[model samples]
Target: YADALRVAQEAAEALPIEKDAIVGANFLLGLAQIEAHTGQSKEVVKTLRQLLTIPAGEYVSLTRLKIDPVWDPIRNDPGFQKLLSEPEPETVYR
Candidate 1:
């Protein structure tokens, strides 16, 4: 998990913005999304919660969380279902 966060941090440095933008949000959200796909629901939930603190988000990006081939692990989880029904912060962009 620590390594995951480090990778996310490094990824942000290589991208277009600083700590509070969508690109940075991607690194964290991507990690969480991947973990969720691989049955890492606890980490996924934790990571997404962290991302929601951002003004906008990188999860649900492309609105893909609902249809993405990844996230199959939690595809049927009640929490994920609830999340889908709730409005995403970036619906306009996604």
Candidate 2:
């Protein structure tokens, strides 16, 4: 899981901001899932927020976050709850 998180973080970082949602969202979602499984609640929420900043394509959506078992670990977190309640972030890029 740690290795997966590391690789995901690296892949997400390697992408240019304008192209982040195209592929980086997948890496960030993987990182968030790894963090959630490994009990990194804060990191999981933080990573999910980062995922939200992108276009929230295949890897993320309010419905997915609420229903995905992978996020159950952090489901009780206030940050996670807030994320679920709030509208999706504005899309600055394609």
Candidate 3:
């Protein structure tokens, strides 16, 4: 878990913010998984928040967070629970 966390962190950092949004989301998902597995609830929730900022995609979703066993460790975290309960933000386009 420690190794996985380290690698995920590194990969996430190495990703270019503009060009790799989707890939970065995937790395965030991996980091969240590692953090949850290693009892780092705070870090896991933080990572999930980061993932949530990415546009709707294939990596993480409120539904997955609610149901996936991988996120069970942080499921009860206030931050995580708040994320689940909050209404989806309104997206506006010009």
Candidate 4:
């Protein structure tokens, strides 16, 4: 679980800016799905919340939540859904 979180963290770092990696959204979704399957929802939420902080998250996160069976626990949580829809900080590359 910890390792998975670490991997997810690393994946998030690779795409801090939208222009850098078009695949960022897919990577975050995959990582969140994996975490949701094997760990506590708290951990899943924690990792995913961190991952979902990527640029232009809305549908990338929501669509993942909607489709992933592993995230069922959080699928209905308002906070979880909000993370998908809320405005994230605009990411900029130096």
Candidate that scores best on lDDT: 2
lDDT of 1 by residue, 33-82 (tens): 65775666666766665565555533454266677767778988777776
For model 3, residues 1-94, the per-residue Cα lDDT tens digits are 7788899889878883355866766776777788888888878877776666667346677877888888887778787888889765442221
Q: Highest TM-score: which candidate?
A: 3
Kindly report which residue stretches of model 3 are placed more than 4 angstroms away from their true locations once superposed.
90-94
lDDT score of residue 14 within candidate 2: 85
lDDT of each: 0.63, 0.76, 0.74, 0.61
What's the TM for model 1?
0.54
Clashes of each: 0, 0, 0, 0
Candidate 2 vs candidate 4, lDDT winner = 2
TM per candidate comes to 0.54, 0.75, 0.79, 0.46
Better model by lDDT: candidate 1 vs candidate 3: 3
Q: Write the per-residue lDDT of candidate 4 for residues 1-94, one digit (tens) a residue.
A: 6787778768866774354544676666666666665645565567566555555455445565668666776676666666667665354433
lDDT of 3 at 26: 73
Better of 2 and 3 by TM-score: 3
lDDT for residue 76 in candidate 1, whole number 0-100? 85
Which RMSD does model 2 reach against the true structure? 2.2
